[model samples]
Target: MVGRLVIVTGGESGIGAACAQAFGAERARVAVYYHSDKDGADRTADAVVRAGGEAMTVQADVDDEASVDHAFTTVEQRWGVADVLVNSAGLNMSGVTVREMTLAQWQRLLDTDLTGAFLTSRRFLNGRGDRTGDAAILHISSIHAYAVRAGGADYCAAKGGLSNLVETLAIEEAPRGIRVNAIEPGMILTPMNAKAQEDPVYRRTLEQNIPMGRAGHASEVADLAVFLASDQARYITGARIVIDGGLSLMQALGA
Candidate 1:
């Protein structure tokens, strides 16, 4: 019920867009960040407006410090300060073994997924006008952080690092009255994985692995983000909430 100001990186589409919509439904003012898809970001902003919330679209590459700084500056100028930040910007790479993976591939994943979070969060914490209570940073991590995929070494490493990074941030920022947490989502239906969804065999295989016997929807992850940002989760910090429909649990069984 709090109409707080919030920032959602990669808000152009996927889970980020869904999170924006969820916050909008609660009438939170949102700053939507998009890297390449201006059209998608605009549509997301429109949806927020339709939900009776205020929204503005900002263009920036999360990995670039200057761009990240500018985006936050723009938000600060317009809204003064934001209370919530959802770092959902990331890049996924599929390739051969560690030996076959080039330095560029590893760097790209780290830059986008890991470094991007650091850059964006650092800018916000330094420039944010509001340093009050109940502020949260929700990093969108992946189950790959714990579970390994053969060709996804770079992605897994970056996510694993981010998972630990959030935990450290939570402990360090707790005294500052800032809360930090992460969400590790399993196979969710989004444009990023639209092709995988179309493959019957792969989709079925993925569904069978989940105890829920289905992939998650973007809205489901968004609901978790909303709850974490709300006062209801005030006591929740330094926690990595998994919304993978028991996929991780199954991994433990195999281990």
Candidate 2:
């Protein structure tokens, strides 16, 4: 992966930051894209550089087509074209039930989670043009894509759609040598789970539900992301790998 141009969305924090640093460890050139947290993005980019990789920070709203295109264009002008796209930009589930969810709320989550994936993936493909070989697109999805949480209708729906999107893109791009896949993580102790990261009492309560007896760390997921984007996973496409410590497996246990 040395010198490979890689684009990481949501590079400001969490899984995205871990992924940026992990790829940097492989000596890949990384474009860290942030929404608003410029400081966090810069910190992540610095970590990438420290890990023996080239790094640049770009401001992008993954949901906006213009912004996505501009961000990719900036990288393309610097480098030729990106070799990989790691879409980690997304919003957590709004704890509103279907009955209570407004149209705006539904659109907002979908815009960032599902629609953003589409925009970035499409822009990546557009930037590639006729060039294709060993390229990959990885989406950081959730186990809720199938687990169906009561108050996560918006989030669950978006991830559910992302599953189809990944599969469809995999088939469409396979002949072109571009692999696409989804990483459905259960419980990772990122900023998204700030409470769990700060409180062992609360964290243990959730971990008890996971068969592995603990929540996963961001680096663990980042390792898997690195593998998926590597040539080692060349045959792995159109598949969604779960890294939730078996938490989703217990969905039907109490029933």
Task: State which candidate has the highest lDDT.
Answer: 2
At residue 11, candidate 1 shows an lDDT of: 99
Model 1, span 1-255: residue lDDT tens: 457898999999999999999899999998999999999999999998888788999998999999999999899998987788999998875567898999988999999999999998888788754466668999999989888889999999999999989999999888778899999999898987887678978888778988999999999999999999888898999999899998888876755
Model 1 residue 131 CA deviation (Å) reads 2.4
The C-alpha local distance difference test score for the whole of candidate 1 amounts to: 0.90
How does model 2 score by TM-score?
0.99
Tens digit per residue, CA lDDT, model 2, 66-163: 99999999999998799999999999998989999999999999999999999999999989998868899999999999989998999999999999
Candidates in order, TM-scores: namely: 0.96, 0.99
With candidate 2 superimposed using the best TM-score fit, by how many Å does residue 92's alpha carbon deviate from the native?
0.5
Local lDDT at 194 for model 1: 82
Model 1 clashing residue pairs (backbone) = none
lDDT of 2 at 8: 98
The top-ranked prediction according to TM-score is 2
- Give the Cα-based TM-score of candidate 1 against the true structure: 0.96
